[model samples]
Every structure is written in structure tokens, then in C-alpha cells.
Target: MRDLYEVLQIGREASAEEIKKAYRKLARRFHPDVNPHDPEAERKFREIQEAYAVLSDDDKRSQYDRFGTVDEGESAARQAHARWAGGRSRVNVSFGGFGGFPDLGDLFGDLFRGGGPVSQAPETPAEAAVELDFVDAMRGTAVVVALRREVECEACRGSGHTSEKVCGRCRGSGRLIHTDRVRVRIPAGVADGDRVRAAVRTTPGGEVAVAVKVRPHPFFERRGDDIHTTVPISFAEAYLGAEIEVGTIWGPVRAKIPPGTQSGQRFRLRGKGVRSVRTGIPGDHFYAVQIAVPRVVTPGGRDLVRRVGELYGVDPRSGLPLGLT
Candidate 1:
């Protein structure tokens, strides 16, 4: 048999949550209903089931890890039968008749006495991608997503059989494919590549995982929780100081540009950035000041510019390094 960790495609030190996650992913891909009549998929699905059964239980996993097998004394057939029975009930097989052979009818009857074999397939979460506007990503919004997921068959109540017969509705798989339009609420300050989980009504504890893709804003950029933007200001505003309206994720707010502010100088507006989704605390917004030069088309305007230029006591580029060290 393949290593259980290899069967689940996880590392040896994988946690219980990781084991469950890997099982759900592989089970969904190789489920009998998903790949009908495919012998390879069926074999792999059974392998995944076996791997999960042992590793999911802490005691069994510890035993397997220490001894390299669960219950080394038991024969393979008995171990397999025990696993299939799930320790719910026990049957005594008597080889009293027919040349000392066990009665097939009695064994089969006891195995399928209740509702046939329990489905080992895990409930897989549905996945969908949602694209959000930049502003919506910052402020949060609800979106309707189309998803397809597997839900238990109501006819058999998740058992493959009903009244000692296979359920026709689910073809004995005990599950049905369902497509639904679900509304998912994305929390504030969700970043690109983040996944948001939403509950599904049909399946208890089932979730729809939506992958977020935030559209790029033309002027604003996000770094962590902080928002960065370049705000253009008149040259006079930078030199003489002025209060201007600045745009933020929340809205426009008044910000002051200090006197003698140079181009590319950054200013911060405290608590004006995107709110942290996990902490609920707003971040600071940082905007770089870009000096916008006005065109001097008139002779009077040129004269005014020259008069302003004369106000500079030293050359702006005097301190700049002109040679490589």
C-alpha cells in the first residue's frame, strides 16, 4: 500500500486540518459520482478514503505513525472489514454448513443490514471567483455568485440505500449535484487573492469559497492596509501652503500641505485609509505631493513666474550629487 501521507499528497507532519483539507480536495476530484465508470478514479477514491480514515483519527494516526500500521496483530481482511463496519455493529460468521464454508448470504445481510456501506466521500466546498471594484474591496460589499456543490440526497438521507434497496434518485451515491445562486458578503479591506467563505444552506457546515480579485484603481494603490496615492497640487500650494480636499477610500477629506513642501514629499492623513478586515482599525493614508506647473502663455504670467523664481535664495539642484562616488 502507498504511504498514507503520499496518498493524501501531504507532508508527514501535516496537521489534522491539513489532512482533512487534502482529503476533501482529492475526494472531490476522484469521487465515483464525479468520474462515473472510471476504474482508475474509483481506485484512487478508495485509496483516499482509506488514508483519511486512519489519519483523521488521532489515536489511529499515532498508532500508524509509531508502528507503521494500525493494529499490527489483525489480519488485512479483518482490519478492512472492521474499518468498513465502523465499529457500529458486529456479526458472528459461522462456517457450519456447505463443506465448512462461511455462508455468503448471512455475511452480506449483516454488512448491508442497515443502509449499505456508508459513503466515505467528504463534502467538498464549492469554489468561485469574484472580481470587485477597488472601492468596493475597501468598503466591502455583497455579491451574488453562481456555485455548484454536492448535497446529500433527500430521498435516502445520505445513505446509499432506503428500505433495504438502493436509492434510485442518487444512483446509490447518496448525493445530488446542486447549482445555486448564493449571496456572499465580502469583508472590508479584502486583498487580492484572498478567499472568503460563505455558508451553504443545503449542506450543514458546507461553505462556498470565493476567491477575490480586486480591480486596480487608476490613481490609488494599496500596500498592506495603507492606501498610497499621488495628489497633484499647484506649485503655489506647495510653496505658500494651502488646505486642499483629498480623496480617500472613505471619501474626500481636507488635508494641509505645509509651506515649502517639495515635490514628491509624502503626507499622511491618520485613520483615512482602508479599515483592517481582521482588526477593524483604519490605517493611515499616505499621499505624495506632486507639484503641477502652470503654463505661462501670457507675458504677464511669464513675468509673475520670473518674479517667483527670484524668491529662491539658492539653486534647487545645488546639493544634488553630479558624480558617482
Candidate 2:
């Protein structure tokens, strides 16, 4: 695996904006259209796109930085930490009682059937990102995504050979561009920027990994599994409690506004929010009350307001620092 930072010529401390700028600059320079005759430049352009894909996403970038690879998800982080700790805290091994550990060379030979290291074939699985709507993410849904990936050529059986001459289909390259359709399922309660990996099955090839991306909701904001939203209420509704319908991911639910409810007061609807990915328990939905005052009033409304003000006879601005000359 290539170091993403090295590929982009960026430091680890590079900001997101800086990474994007570098990617754009290099992409344009190495784009196939610009370097029409250079096949190597086209390959480099693909590599750049792959690097930016990993570095541009926050979650993926964190995973890559900590584990040096994003393919294993959280397990990569744990494995990296274990390796680091093993290096820092070395322990003496007691192999005397366990028939003495086999030699490293022999163990690798047994594993690989030879003295050489085991190498991954070009049919290694691929990863592609798929974006989904917020509502679709809230409720689990399946989508078929079209993926452009490299697959071993069938003409030469991935050898790029046909009786000594290069395979015309792949042009001496063992791989060919293939379009794959894979169904990826987005689990319930998946937040924006969260990734879900689904395997893509192919004939004579390794499985492909699909990464799911949930789009941001317009009105609803998610905190863990809980949903937060603001509900606008009129002055009358805030002063005098009323039952109003509130929109939820599940649907509309009626909520009672308590008398004397003030602006910014939050109300929670239990079991009405997103479901937990691990526990499958639904979280509560919290709605903040936003009291909206009337910008313009009718003659009758103005008269009623004036009468109410006269009856109250209390100065709302009494605590203010401003002075009336």
C-alpha cells in the first residue's frame, strides 16, 4: 500500500482544504486527457484519485492515519495498537515447554508452500463509495451501485499471453476495466459520514467492498442515535399548552407543549429517534421549542394585544439598562 500523504505530497498535519487543493492540482496535471500519450500518467491519475478518496473523508482518514490502511476498519486500529504495545512492552517467551517454536523461515515456508513471502494476487477485492439519502439511511435500505473496477482478463486468464503474443483484449495488461453492480445495504441509524462495508461477489475474482455514505438531513441533526430538531410554535401555543404534531423519522407524532413553555425548551420523545447499530434500541427524539413572534398583526389582533398589555400593567423592559428621557 502506498502512503496516502506521500502520494499527495502532503504532510500528516495537512488540513482537509490543503489535501483537496493538492489533489485537484495533481489530478489536472496527470489527467489522461492532458497527458494523452502517457499511459503511466493515466495510471498515476487513478492512484491520485484513490489517495484523495481515503484522505478526504474524516473517518477514513483517521483510520488510515492510525492503522496505515483503511481496509480493515476499526480492527486495523486495534491491531496497530497491539503491535505498538508489543514493541514497547516486550515479554520473554517460554517456548521450551511448547515443543520449541518452529523456525521463522520454516513457518513461512509452510504457510506459503515456499520460502518466499505470500503475495496477494491482482484479483484482490476493491472498495467503492455509495451515497444514500438521509431518510433511506434512517430506515435500512438496499441499493445497487455501479462500480468501475479492475478485473482479471478472461482472454489470457490474467496472464496477458496468447501463444507468446500479448493478449489483444487487455493489451499485455493482466487486468481490464469492468463494471460491477453490487447491492449495498445501509443499516438503520447510520449517521452521516459513517461507513458500511458490503461484499461484492464476482466470478473468477475476489469480493469487492462497498462503502456506504449517508447524506445529511436538511432539518434533523443526529447526535449518536438521538435526533435533534427545532419546532416553531406561536406565542399563544407557548403560553397556553396545546397538542401539536411533530415530524419524526418514523412519522408525525403529537406532542403536548406545556403551559409557560419558553423558547429553546427541549422536549424528548422516547423511542422515536434512530436505532442503535449495535443494540438495536431506538433512541429518543429531542425537539426544541422556538417561539416565533408575529411580525405583523391585524387590527383586531393589535387591539387585543393592546388590551392585554393594559390589563397586565407590567413593564417588560423594566430590567433593561436603557433609559427613556
Candidate 3:
């Protein structure tokens, strides 16, 4: 794995603004929508997001700086505990160190041996992340996710015994490391940050949690049920109303642009957006109409545009407040 700073293309001393700017630039360039069909681009994009997630947070960044990796604190703490338990404490440590201090090693011996925690505090299930394409997320799809989890021993069925005898395979321990490949069904209209729980006997005491990450669409964005996009039209097309084909998740549909439509004007197509998961009622598809002016116009075209401007003779921004910069 690449270092977080290297993944984000920033120096260790980079400012927060610089880090954010780098992330945005990289995200835009390598976004799946921008580089479709390129697995390398998609991988880089995921890496960029991961880097930003760590560097964007103060606590995570500090942890990363102190340790080589973000999740090393727990392992480090355990190692320190082992050293103290052996009476070879290189670093000063104290956690209810009164008499002879509880034997953290023996207390957590079960945890180290995969026997599971002894505390009443519910064990936190191991978490894994799965990424899905934008379309796959919109239309429900099944994906196979591989996870390493703690599971009940098959021979003992988590009872640690069989016929009043300790199971030889598990040696009376009902839990063991299990690598599970599970097919998860993603629901339609599932947005980013959504989690789909798949119950598995990974741990004898707990389950493994999987987080779903949806890749961002190139041209479309969803808000609630509405799908938004920006479609550019020629100057003449904006002046003279025309029916233009707009792309939607289902397919392409024709949308009519009214005459004299201004730049930045938004048009809505009813019932053309995403379908609601609850009521099944589809939302509206909204497209902002942006006028595309020709950079290099012919002499005749320039003359015609000048004439049209003179004929209209109206300042569109006349209603603006006075002394506006």
C-alpha cells in the first residue's frame, strides 16, 4: 500500500487547503466516469479517496505520522502490554497499576488465541468495504465479496463439544478464522454511504460488517430521487426552441428547450428520474441548459449575431443591484 501522503500527492507538511486541492484535482482526473473501462484509473481513484479520508482527518493524520499505518495503535498497545507483562517494560505504562497490575496478557489470552473477548461490551464485528459501479448501485445487482472473519468451528457448531466430548478439530474452541466469499444483493436506488448487512457465522460471537461504496457518475448526480445533469446547447438551438435528447439511467429521452432560453436555465422531465425504493414513484430528471457559443465565428455568422443583438436591445442583467462588482 502506498503512503497516505504519497497517495494524495502531498508533502507531509502540506496545508489542509493544499491537501484538499490535490484530492479534488486527482479525483476529477481519475474518476471512473472520466476514465471508464480503465481498471488502473478506477484503482487510483479509490486510492485517492482512501488517502483523502485519512489525511483529511486530524486524528487519523496524527496517528499515521506516529505510526507507519493508521490502525497500528491497537497492535502497538498490545505489544506494549506484552512487554510489561514480561517485566521488561522499556516504556513507562500505567493502566490501573496498583498492586501487581492485572495480567493483561493472561486477561487477553483468549482474544489472542481467537477464543473471543471476555468482556460484556459487545464485540465489534470486523468491517470490509465493497465498491460498486454507479449503474450497478442504481439497479440492484449481486456481488461476491471475500472477507476474512472469525467463524464458529464446523465440527463443534459453536458448542465446543460433540456428544459430551470435546471436538478434536476445534479442540473445544468454537471459533476460528474463516475466509468467506458471500454474494450480497444490492438494493435499487441505494445511494452512497449505504450499508447492506450480510449475516454470516464468521465469528462465534459476532458478525462481519460490509460497507458499500458507490463510484461517482461522470455526467449525472442524484439528490433524493432527482437526477441532475448539465447539457450544453448551441446558441441557435437556445434562441430557436429545439427538442434535444437527454441521457437518463433508463435510456435517452427527448427534452424540449423553450425559445429564448437563457444560459444556466434548468429543464425538468417529470417521472424520468430514479425510482423510489419505498413508494416506487419515480422522481423528475433535471438538466441545466448551458448555451455553447462558438469561439471562432465566420464573417457572415458574426454579422448576423451583431444584428440579432441589436434587434433584441435588452440588457439581461439590468435588474441587478447597483454597483455590483
lDDT of 1 at 290: 93
Give the TM-score of each candidate: 0.54, 0.54, 0.53
How many clashes does each candidate structure show, in the order listed?
0, 0, 3
Query: For residues 21-106, what per-residue lDDT tens digits would candidate 1 score against the true structure?
Result: 78765654455433445688777877776788788888888888898887742344345445645532332322111112112222
**Model 2, span 1-325: residue lDDT tens:** 6788998999999999899778765664454432435678766766776777778879889988888888854354344335434543332221111112111111111221223543356443455566778888888788777778688999999999888999999998989999877776666765443444454556233444344556678898765567889999997898789899999988999999998888999999999988865447887899999999788889999998887677445686777888685
Score candidate 3 by TM-score against the native: 0.53
Per-residue lDDT over 43-65 for candidate 3, one digit per residue giving the tens place of the 0 to 100 score = 78767766776777788778888
Ranking of all candidate structures by their TM-score, best first: 2, 1, 3
| Per-model lDDT | 0.71, 0.67, 0.67
* Lowest lDDT block of 10, candidate 3: 91-100
Which pairs, if any, clash in model 3?
A: 150-202, 150-203, 151-202
Best candidate per lDDT, number? 1
Better of 1 and 2 by lDDT: 1
